[model samples]
Target: MIKNGYRNDCFVASVLLTLYANFGELGGVEKLFRRIGDKDITAWNSMILAGARPGHGSSHSMQLLQELCQTTLLQIESATWVAVLKSCENESDLVAAFVDIEWKDDSSWSSIIGTYKQNDMELEALGLCNCKEMLNEGVNFTSYSLPLCFSACSQLSAICEGKQLHVLAIKSGYNRDVYVGSSIIDMYAKCGNIEESENVFSEQLEPNEVIFNAMICGYAHHGKAQQAIEVFSKLEKNCVAPNHVTFLALMSACSHAGYVEETLHLFTLMLDKYKIKPKSEYYSSLVDAYGRAGRLEEAYQIVQKDGSESAWRTLLGACRNHNNTEIGEKSAMKMIEMNPSDHAPYVLLSNIYNAEGKWEEAIKCREKMAKIHVKKDPGNSWLV
Candidate 1:
């Protein structure tokens, strides 16, 4: 097309740029972008999207947006801002782009808040959602934003903030939304108020699979294995099909309560009855259940069959508690081979040796960590 003198056409050039970006042809995109003499907003946005394309570093996208802001007279709209925001790889870059947006629309607000949630900046996400300035600017919280806000509250265990958001949901008539209801349940349960979670769940007029799953997970987290099982039975009676999450939560509940046989039964039911393939997390949960029962050999056998690094780590931690140096050594060795840079396996190994009264072996584990410069991560307390 360029050879046919279509290079000067902004629309044609923009389409070509998107095609190249989608194909991961960054070099072709760069050359073609430079050759476009008259660039419109469409052309500029295409270039930005190209830079923001997955696997291509977002740095170039951010740089192009910066350059476009300083050089181009073309009006940067919400779409342009959203495109660049998608490329922000870190919190600082995202905040900078957000500040640069001339008009903060719902899309922009949702993008920033969602990014904050994804980056584990739950506090920041919640703060922005409830920011007085944001509300005064007439940025109404939509159903999409409400769920995200509730999730942030759940992560922080901010029951006070969560209740405030819950009231907002009710006022906005979004409390009936299945997603919002589910989030409310999760927030309440995670904040150590399972009764409130139950209230939220029971108040739903027509709960779906997601709502049931949320309630079950809440019960599981609180070690209410019987309640979780009853919920599962109710789900079956209601003809609501259970997903993988349902089984996962049930297995977790059994594991927490040291119900190894029930956990095993659930795993079998997931595979044979539900025909849902078990994930690595399922295997890890299974190992955890057996380990909690002090059945290290059974856990080891399960690990050998289809264990991931996480499952091996679970077994190693179990071995530490059981003071079984033989399995602990093997589990640690397997985990280290899977991720040599990880400090968790080494730390668990040291703990196991210490538990067994092998000070020299524990010292050796520490020395090895020092030699590899694999520093242990310091723990932090969760702020209430």
Candidate 2:
């Protein structure tokens, strides 16, 4: 195609770039991407995604995005901002990219705020919404941006901020929006106000799947298994189809309430009836349910079948609680094999040993952690 003078064709080059990225051919992707004469947003997005891949160095992707930003003729779409955000390694990088945009659109604000929330920087995410510069720039909150701000408030348990954002949503006429409503429910529930969450949920006359999932998740977090189940019944009565999040929340609720049988049944329903394939979280939840019911062997068996690091860690945690040194050691070993740098398995294994009065083994576990330089992260309080 290149020999036939199709090299500079935007569509063809963009397709080639995506193919190279998928194949992990970063060198060829870069070479061919630079050769495209009339580079469109598609080409830029392709290069950005390619460069952001695991080993390709997000710095290169950020550089490419910066170059694209400098090209005044090309319009940077939300997709481009999303691609660049994926390349941002830290909060500073995200803020820098956010502030660099000359013309901030609703999508741009949503993208950066959502990224901050995803990175667990909820305070920073909320800061963007209340930032003096953004306020001075006359940035208005739309449905898209409002949902993310609500989610940030949820993460931080910032009830005051959440209520203010709720008012903003209502004032902007986005209170009726399904996504925004869901976020509001989630925010209220997470801030220890399930009653308000229920109120918000009840007000949504035409509750969709997302809204129902949020309500169910609220119940799950509050250990209201019966309430979650009742909501699920209503969801079915209303003929609203439930998705993975719905079942995950149900499983979590059942697990927390020690309703092991209910949790198992929901797992089967999700798999056989809903045909939803279980991911690591699903498996971890199942292991947690079984472990909480004092079914350590069953939990271990589930972990063996899944063989994911998360499942193993869950099982290890269960073993620690049950004081099952044997299975705890196995789970810890499996987790270590999967991710040697993780200090969680080491810490859990040591706890398991100490719980069983095996002080020597616990000491050995700590020594191994030190030898490997696997430093455990210090705990911090979100309230502060």
Candidate 3:
């Protein structure tokens, strides 16, 4: 349609551009965007939206925003700002883009706070909960806002802050909202307040998969394998089918508590009963269970079959944990084969040799790292 001089029709071309972007076909959007000569606000917004799609990040959208500002006399609008804000991949960039908005609406404010929590900038997310500008603008908290606020509080272990949010959630009558309920459960569990988490879980009139998953994950984090599995059983009894995330949390709980048999059984059940394809995280947890049990051979077989670098790294870490020199050497070699430029395999292999008191082998591993020009990262730790 665009090829038959429709590109000259700015309205038609812009519609085509918006349609392409809506379908996540950035290539078509780019082609349509370039063909238009004198673009208006709608055309610019469509181009910006396309750039904001996944894989392109915010680079293209930000570039277009700057170009629109410098060259075009048209003022940037709210939709454009929101598109750029949504494109931001990290907390700092998200903050910068958000502050560029001429007017902060409820949706834009929600995006900013949600971005903070999504990026794991918990302290910042918590701080955003009290933004004076947003408060002055009468931007009220919604169901979406409560979850991230609770998540940040949970992560920072700000029990006082969490309590405040809990009060707000109840007073606003959103406490029973399934997503809010799940977030509350997650926050309490993460803050080492499992009792509070359980209370919230029990209060749910009808829990969804998310609520069940959160409770199971809470138990897993607390190393309460019995409780986690028991929750899974409850979910099954309630006829709430488990998803991939559910299985991941369940397997992790069993792995951490050394329930190797249960871990394997759950993995089998996930494939045969639920028909969930094994994601890398799932395979990694299963491999970790075997590795933690010092079953190096089984771990190796699983990682190789799974074909994930992170899973292989887990197996390698397990080798170091159990001091299995032979399997550690094999894992190290395979990791190097997979990613020659990565420093992890070299560092892990060298540590394994050092742990076993094989000084020569350790020195050789370091030499190989040096030869490959993959500098080992400096040792660092935080006082948590």
Candidate 4:
């Protein structure tokens, strides 16, 4: 009693399966598949896409696909196979195995290349890039695939390859695309070409918030705190209201410069002026700023205000720096109470006792740690 008078029942079943899959009702889709008796190629594709979509599915979606490929001996469409391969890139062994599998078309090759890039398998990604040239099959690289390859070049710090990709992006008319533009900026930043990053940012036809955030982070990460702050000022003047990420970049800059007053001012602005509630990361940065400046009391006060374990740990670290046994003991107790398995506070407390010449107390602390199997992290000096 189907109303549409659709002659092909399999087509109707496939449409319903796709609907269920898209809505994440996989069990319902499976039930429909079972009722349909003989599932067609479209039905199988619908099921495959269901598992490949971002959330509410297993990472083993690709394995399921491989199983399907073997059982049916069916020629999987390029789009379906590409989705499965993209999922496998996260597994290095799988990527290596699948590289030998026959692809449907050039798009499939681009997909595999992009997958390798996304997974940080730069060598594999580069190999695919070289393979495309060797074949000389006139493969048309899509906008989606080019950014990913550019990302791999960025990670490898291959300035030459990155520049070539930028030129390709311009030629493909994707230079103004937000995703492509962001990748270009990130590549320049990673290659230590801040001027190039800035130039790209300036030429962006419609720079999105992500592009601005990347620029800000690049300056902050390279110790150009002043430049980071200047970017924020420009963002404000341009009337692009700052988001959470914008504040994070600003806070990072403040933290690196040890500008306590400015840090406090920005922190307040985030909460009051901007009306953005401070996230745990924001609080942690504030604690780090106060701690590094040897303002243990200020660090302690921030933790007291926001009762987060991460904030407490930051305060405890500051206590260790100042060797404030009293505050250290309190912070350690609080941290342990928050999460007993945390080893940091115990080690910090023991160090505090050792600094105060309380060897017996330190030894007792060590023994307690031994009973709980807590181990201290190896100490390494940070130059900056």
Candidate 5:
């Protein structure tokens, strides 16, 4: 086409750019992009999507959008931002894109709202959720939207709002939905309404593993470990086969209660009786259990055997909590060796030195971090 002088056409060039980029020909895309005299939103969007692929700068899409926003009169659409979100690594950035969208459908709203609530932006999530325009537009209030809103209220401990939603659920007939029912249980428990959570649990009909998991996890979170154990025992009696998540919740209960013997017994049953493999997260949880119980050596040995970065970090944090400098230093060194680029182990190791008043050692650790250019991320705290 270029040989036939179709290269003079911006539309053809833009289409060629997209095709080439989609075919993994970045070079061809760049060539066609350069030949186009005037790049418009379509051409820019294609280029941004291409750059957002793996092994490319994840921020390139955002950079292109910024350029387009400054240069073009074209209105940004839902597709454009959704494409940008494909490359977003953090929820905060997603929120940045989300707030700019002038209009969206149910799926878009549900997706962003759920994501916002997940990233601890309950306030922002709920704000959009209750946006009067959305309500006026007659957005569907199905199971999807209700759970996240309830979750936000629960997380914020907004019991009055949660009850309001429960009322809404009853009126809307969403309370019977399994997903909504589970979220309702979780919300009640999170908001410290144990009685309400229990009532919801008892009222559930033909509940699945997820609902049972929610109830057990809620009990575990509230320090009612024995109750959690009782719930686990009831699973078999109810003829519901427990998944690994069920055992994780049950093990977490034992761990929280400092029932070391019981925790170990459950771990064995999870493997031999239930035929479940101990994932890295389960190992980390086990390490946490021992660490919290002042059983440092046991935790350290388990972490050492597991050899997962997260497990080692968990053990290291436990050492820090217990003020066990020796284990902390060792764990920190191992973690740094495993992933030299991460700032967490470096910061924690330096803190361990500082905490022990080893000024020279602390200075050395700090210097190493500086030399490696590993900048510790600033800490963030969320109210809800």
Candidate 6:
């Protein structure tokens, strides 16, 4: 849109810059802003915001913010201040450098709190929260920012801090807020407080698919497959259609519990009922589940049907475990045909032969690999 010479309207250009920045196309955003010729404070604010958004590296954003501070003669606005503060929060070194700078309002405080939270500096985030409370200075922190602080505490497994943040959130009437509630549930779950996670989920005014997925993943990851399945069932009862992540969680639960029959059922349902095609991870899990159960034929069939290198590799791993040379050779051959340059199959095949005390065969395989120039690269261990 900026390419068509529509840079006259600052508001339109600001919106465009925001969109580009959100999408990580910062270069395009800079091009448009520079073409405006007479850059306004709003344009500068937009550029700062574009740079400070999460997932955008803080170093580059900080550099641009410093340049703006040096070059611009205009008074710095609150928005620009917030963006720069946020960049500082994202990087701890910057936070220490900017700590003495006086922030005019709660937004700037929130930005600092969010940065500490995002960087997993739990104590720092909690300390700032306490400072806000001590000020009692009538600055109402935004509902959105507190959850990030709680998330930090959760990451650190600081349950006490997380609970304090939870109380603050409720007192501030943000308990029922979907985003806040989801973060709280996730925090509790991540901290291994499953009961607290459930309590938070139950209290939510409107739990979305994301919240449901979080709970499901939490249960699956913690080896509570039955609980994960129950949560998934409830999600379905609530009319929340499962997405790709939903299936992945379900597969994880099944794989963990070695519920081969259930895994097969869910895999079929994912394709036929939900119309969700299997991803590489899903296929790999299927192969792993079957292979672990000593069902080599079933594992091979899955790899053949999926045609994924990961799936084939899973079968090869199983063959190694069971000492099934016949199937192992077939799997290795198939893998080489699919990706001849990959050194994994050759190494795995050679290992399989060595395990069987077939040293001659192993040497022959190594000779064949050398002829094909398929040498193992340093630091590329097959185990990982």
Instruction: Please write out the lDDT profile of model 2 over residues 1-384, one tens digit for every residue.
Output: 999999889999999999998998999999998899888889888889888787555678767866776774676666776677677676677677667667776556776776666667789989888844555887778777788888888878899989988877777788899999999999999999999999999989799999999999999989899999999999999998889999989998988889899999999998998899999898888999999989999888888888888889889988889999899989898889999999999999999888889999999999999999999999998895
Clashing residue pairs for model 6? none
lDDT of each: 0.87, 0.86, 0.85, 0.75, 0.79, 0.78
Return the TM-score for candidate 3, rounded to 2 decimals.
Answer: 0.74
**Of 2 and 3, the candidate ranking higher by TM-score:** 3
Q: Name model 5 segments beyond 4 Å from true.
A: 1-125, 128-140, 155-157, 323-326, 343-384
- What's the C-alpha lDDT at position 133 in model 6? 59
| lDDT of each residue in 243-263, candidate 6, tens digit only | 888878888788778888878
Query: What TM-score should be assigned to candidate 6?
Result: 0.69
My TM-score estimates for the predictions, one after another, are 0.75, 0.69, 0.74, 0.73, 0.64, 0.69
Rank ordering of all candidates by TM-score, starting from the highest: 1, 3, 4, 2, 6, 5
TM-score of 4: 0.73
Worst 10 residues of 3 by lDDT: 94-103
Model 1 spans with C-alpha error above 4 angstroms: 2-12, 15-44, 47-79, 82-109, 119-121, 131-140, 363-384
Q: Write the per-residue lDDT of candidate 1 for residues 153-271, one digit (tens) a residue.
A: 99999999999888888887888999999999999999999999999999899888999999999999899999999999989999898999999999999998999999999999889
On a 0 to 100 scale, what is the lDDT of residue 149 in model 2?
87
What range of 10 consecutive residues in model 4 has the weakest lDDT sum?
A: 96-105
lDDT of 4: 0.75
Model 4 alpha-carbon drift over 4 Å, by segment: 1-42, 45-114, 117-123, 129-135, 377-384
Scored by lDDT, the top model is: 1
Q: Taking the tens digit of each residue's C-alpha lDDT, what string does model 5 give over 275-338?
A: 9989887888788889889899999999987899999999888887787888998999899999
Model 3 stretches astray by more than 4 angstroms: 1-112, 115-124, 131-139, 381-384
